[model samples]
Target: MTLLATHLVSRLRLKHLRLVDSLARSGNLHRVAVEMHMTQPAATKMLQDAEQLLGAQLFERRPRAMVLTEIGTFVADYAARLLRETDSFAEGLDNLKAGGFGALAIGAIMATTPGLLPRAIAELKQRRPLMTIRLIAATSDILLEALSRNEIALALGRLTEPKDALAFDIEPLATEELWIFTAADHPLASRESVSMAELARLPWVLQPHTSPMRRLIELTLARQGLGSLDNRVETTSIFATLHLVREAGMIACLPKSILVEGVARGTFARLPVALPNQLGPLGIITRKGETPSANAADFIDVLRSMTAPGEELG
Candidate 1:
């Protein structure tokens, strides 16, 4: 029985899985062939072989595209999961052979990219220059979703709120105070301190409404009895937000680290806002009870060292 199972799995080659997945995604055999760099006849034969092995018709042929039958959907989903695990297993073996340096898939919020991530990545490069790092910049919701799906090994961002509970572990790194920033010459830049009520009157360059940062800002404003600033300009681009704050004299809330260099260099000025509760926790999140890749574990060690004071490497 084990031999029979091994033979069946071997027959479902990576090439066959690729053909099926490509067809499912593109919904056409010719397009799948084009994508796989194969001839149409070859692609068709691969699909036929896959269907014959499974003993079922995988897709219903349509005029413009093919639709997966119910069984086909199940097969495609299982095939994808198998391929992902296979790739991960291969990476693990390769890392074990190469002195523990391997590939890592990381997800980070846009806010982390400018500061924490850059510092961590620089350290990682110095430690293992050949290590492969794939970064996906996204919101916390998206990152958490990817992490849960095992598409990414680790994530660095603000801690997700309680409503987003999942089977993951969070390691606190640092608590960064969010600061209001504006162009150097803006009127509020010279103020010794300003209340939220006073600062709420200005035009703001806000993060997307769905973002955790935006939600934090809104909640803070509401608690201060100030209405949410109309987002006349909404953007997910942190760089663009900085430029707009510098050139357009608009207000933006961002992590202190993101604006520290600029504030020091006089490109932008940190507003003197009384924000006692404007701090957010940044952390590393990973799936609970799952061992990370060697490279990921090493990188996490570096991250902990960088964020923690007086911590010796174990």
Candidate 2:
């Protein structure tokens, strides 16, 4: 058992796991080496070492493909899980040394920041004042990619469709209804609600065309047979949109969260238009089968509590 343990320790080095994960992703040893910034020979040797320790052939070296053998696939899966857990453990230990309860790295889309995330952060800080929190504001696509790369502990944003590809455990936090918003003094704001036809006639402030929100908005408008409006202002800035809507009287559709406080303060008004809930469900997404940092998990729990039914949003 002692010899076996030593052999296993030598095989499960960080370099070995990195090689295994890369090969599993690319299915090519040369590509894995290139991605890891190592020579192909070194990568080949690492794989050989790992396979020898496990006493199993991990790959079938076909001319056109480096396919995983049954055992190889299993080992790769387990290796990925092991690496994730090891990272979480290391982070937890670092937090202990720093005299903090734990560290949380979180990503949030712009729309979520105004209400959803602030509430979570405030609650977390109040409870775990010593904990370290890192917040990143980005678009959904950027946040998702960062989450996949393990740069952030978790992401808070609209749930992605075709959920299978997300490969995460998602806990729904809130479902913010979409609404058309404009400055309180805007002509359309005077109306209790505006028609979709009327909405399409105004100059619009919108997210960039590449965004999922923009695509969904366009599709919804097209389905209604409404010709596109003058998209004179294209931006990813939620604050800019809010300001534009409040001061410039430009029309923009946004999740209720973004304008909640502004609407309450009479800076903006929600149009009484029957807009479809273009806003998707908001949720916390974490890599599946991986344990999060204690602080991250605790922060998520706090967010869940704050957004629970009957809880008031500040």
Candidate 3:
């Protein structure tokens, strides 16, 4: 290694980064000092030293609160990420000392959260009771980003086909079907089957504009000659979508599996409309070279075993 690279860490301490993170949060020296357990002058000098060490002024000091300069924001973000990693490392050490298995971070999409993941998690818990688990439910786009950042060890979500699959070890777990749903007491709920044209006339609750599901909704509506949905609520959160559809009499499109829990509780109803049934394969996505620890490997096995027989793991 170069001499500068070798000595760089020796010149910097974790406390400096902590001060930067704290300053970024409060933006006021007095409050930052209290949070860091240092005097105000000490906090101020630490900020100055950090800026000097980084070879740039990090914050623009105002009369009351300091505003982060462009570089300051970047540094703060890096510091925060590093701190999180540090804590995770510490947790792993603690777990090892306690005769416990290490942690596993998983990123799951909507389809798996309500159906596949819960059972697998329960089984993994029974097998590896002391393993720490962190579950983040989001879209494929977000999950892929997390996987790339090592924020998640593996992802259970949509898998890209041959083109993008080259960068990841993609496994086909299941095919998800979509459904149109609304509150149980909705005007159209008791009908035999409503036409898409008729349903499009009602207010809707839809996914965010960027989600693949939303694009499908738009495509389906466009084929029926409807310009756009009269949707006033757009969210990615399933809980919020359920509440809006259940209480406000709005309609939405979601994976069929996500409704099982709600439908069982009588909070939502599936509309008897023939919506699109095709979705690209949803599966386990891991980095091309990613290797799972023992805990994650066991969880992966449980996930595979939980897949329905017809939708076999591949």
Candidate 4:
């Protein structure tokens, strides 16, 4: 290294950096001295020593305040940055020692949003009030995509493709149940039992063909000799499906958890027809080779505890 660079790397110390950073903020020796718990003369001597070592005048002394020379501003700015980074490193180290005190971004399918994920998140927040959490509510495919892009640290959703098994680490959480819902006033609402043939003939509000729920419905119907749905409105939004089921008198096949409020409110009625196949197990998905962040690991622990009691996915 050059002589000047060697002098800086070898001689510059934390105290020198702190004093310059303080000077940049206060612009007065007396205040900087008081803040540093040092006398004014000591502070002045330190600054002079720094200037002499650097072979440059760092500040212009006036009657009232000290103004930074051009080079002093650059040096002080870098010193301030260094101090900030040092403080951040110290805080993160402390948090690591204490456990679970950082930011976490997680994604979940709509099925988990109503009950399962919320309870887990609330419990995590209670344990770590200073933690920052970002929740993304989306479909399983979308959640998987977020995981691939590193947009989320982990996901509570299904694996949409066979290849996902190779790319992500999965821990099965709970199996989701599919239910048929209709408006309370629909013709089939009061029936004790409905034949699959009869139900297949009715208008339906369904998710897109690509969604897992939709695929399950199609597969189940095909097994029952019902070829495919002809009269259906395709939607990915829960609100839109609910509206169509209630206002348009259409049948909707949705996760059991999402219909709790509507069923309680008398806006929706569950049909008597039972699906032969249960949906795939929902699980935690994270990048395969990477270690989870401290906050991610802690949040995952909270989620696992909630699911450990045989709590089915809501």
Candidate 5:
């Protein structure tokens, strides 16, 4: 083996990795030392040792802040990733010793949380009772960001754009149907069928312009020679939309799954108009090249089984 490789494998310490990782965040040796519960001189010694061992300068000492050299940036990034995996491994071992399966963290879009995620979680727990599972409910855009940051192992949502296909291993699970709705007692709610132009005249409660739902609404309207809605309130919250529809007399377009319960309870009524543009297919997304952990793979199996023939997602 090369001398540097030999030195790294034999002499590198966890404290050294932690120092670099902390330095990357704080950019100040004294602050990193305080965070690591060591003296500043000790921190400096660790940094020097790391630089000498790697045969590359890590941080450039500046008056106000230490800046990472190119090699330092790469090493710091790797150290951070390595630290995360180490923590995960320790946690997995602890769980196994406690007679539990390893933990899993997954994110899902708002529409999927109402039914899909809960059902899948229930099924997974039945198979692995002590497995730890965490779910983050948010918009697809937020979920994708979390996925990219390694904050989530899996995501159940739509790809925000075509380029997302290249960044993630996306498995198309199901298609969501978009429907328009209003409060049960609204004037338009009683109509057997409503025209798009007539509905366009009324105020609406809609997701923000960046959301996939809102883009679909714009596309559908544009296809019909109608412009974007001018008389609309924008929000990303489903609860807010429901409130505006019920108390403020504003119309909303949402997934059928999200509205089914409300419609059944006589709280909201589905509009008769059909939209020309449909939201893209919902899918399972993972980092493109990495494999899912055993527990994550099992949970995915549950999701797939639930969506199998004759039992499609609603």
Candidate 6:
């Protein structure tokens, strides 16, 4: 058996994962030891034991702070997820006794937040009022990681690249285009048309560097000779971007679907600029080779049914 496989035997315990999680989160042995209510030496020995059990060093000891090895990241990821699920499972028991079904925790990209998911959520609530529904809105990569750790039952996000999509069983939903949106009162709101150069001159709030949306914006900037944007802020929250754009007279390049409601409500306005090569496919990403809980499965069915006939995913 491989070292990872070997470590998955009866040798590993929950405490080992806790140690890994604490170390990853704190990145300082003394601090994490204090958090775990153990001496520094005991924490060090526990880390060493965990490394030995796994046949690999989970962290690299540095002068100032410790850093996780690649394997350590996996350990921490699973550890955090295990804790979340454990708490939810405890809640599940009480819910079950109260005539409630199991929970369906969903992780989704911002693009799905407004148009697709709300309708599906409403339908699920009406049909299964006893089901506990939870949501974690984040970028696609974050959603994928959560799904992988079984932290979430379903994900609605984009598969921007080839490598990341392989981990999930993705069902094609619909293609959504990115748009440059601003508050209706902004100066650019009344422009007949705008170009990348013109929009780049305005204050902006962009997505985090790691997000696919930001990646696309970066690529577009590079092509348009707008490197090193005058970014006012960087965030993963669409709501935050909306707030900034509305109050601060800033611009945002985000999914068209997310901005539609705001535009229809006259809170935000889409710029007339044309973006090349900025289309993203939105889809449903489920755990590979695993079945979700019955309510979650039913929610998935609701999502599929809610999609318009052509946009319906397989």
Q: Against the unseen true structure, what C-alpha lDDT does each candidate score?
A: 0.79, 0.77, 0.81, 0.85, 0.86, 0.81
Q: Which stretches of candidate 6 lie over 4 Å from their true place?
A: 1-8, 28-78, 81-85, 225-228, 309-314
**Model 5 spans with C-alpha error above 4 angstroms:** 1-35, 38-81, 191-205, 208-210, 224-236, 309-312
lDDT of 2 by residue, 44-122 (tens): 9999988887899998888876888999899887777677767766876797688877667789987677777887898
Model 4 Cα lDDT, one tens digit per residue, 1-314: 99889978899888998999899888899999999999999999999989888888889898888999999998887787677657655665675677647667799988888888889999998988877677888788888877776667899988877998899988888877778989999989999989879988889988778778888889889998887889999877888988898899999988889987788898899998888887778988999998988778988898888785345765
lDDT of 5 by residue, 1-314 (tens): 99868879899888889999989888899999999898999999999999998889999999999999999999998788778778777887898899999888899987787788899999999999988777888778888887886778999988888898788988888887888999999999989988887877889998878678888888878787888799999887888989999999999998888998889999999999888767777888998999999988998898888784333355
- Compute each candidate's TM-score over C-alphas: 0.74, 0.65, 0.82, 0.65, 0.75, 0.82
Off by over 4 Å in 4: 1-102
Evaluation by TM-score, superior candidate among 2 and 6: 6
> Across residues 1-314, which tens digit of lDDT does each residue of candidate 1 receive?
69767888777788888777778888989878888898999888889999998889999999989999999998887777667767877886787588666678899876567666888999998988867777988777678878766778999865566745457788877666677888889988888877778767778998778778788888888887878796458887788888899888899987776777889999888887756665456678888888987789988998887777422111
Q: Give the range where candidate 2 is weakest over 10 consecutive residues by summed lDDT.
A: 305-314
Predicted candidate 6 versus true structure: per-residue lDDT over 1-314, tens digit per residue: 88767757678777788888888988999998898899999999999998888778888989989998998888888788887788789878788889987677998887777767888899999988888888999988788877878788889887656877567787777777777888999878888888888777777898777788778877888898787677569988777888999999898988777777788899999998767876556777887787778887888888878775335222
In what order do the candidates fall by lDDT, top score first? 5, 4, 6, 3, 1, 2
Alpha carbon deviation, residue 271, candidate 4 (Å): 0.7
Number of backbone-clashing residue pairs for each candidate, in the order shown? 0, 1, 0, 0, 0, 0
| lDDT (Cα, 0-100) at 170 in candidate 4 | 87
User: Candidate 2 versus the native: TM-score?
Assistant: 0.65
User: Is candidate 2 or 3 superior in lDDT?
Assistant: 3
Question: Model 1 reaches what TM-score against the true structure?
Answer: 0.74
The top-ranked prediction according to lDDT is 5
lDDT per residue for candidate 3 within 112-215, as digits (tens), equals: 77657888999999998888999999877778777766677889887533455766776777887788998999888889979888877788888766566777
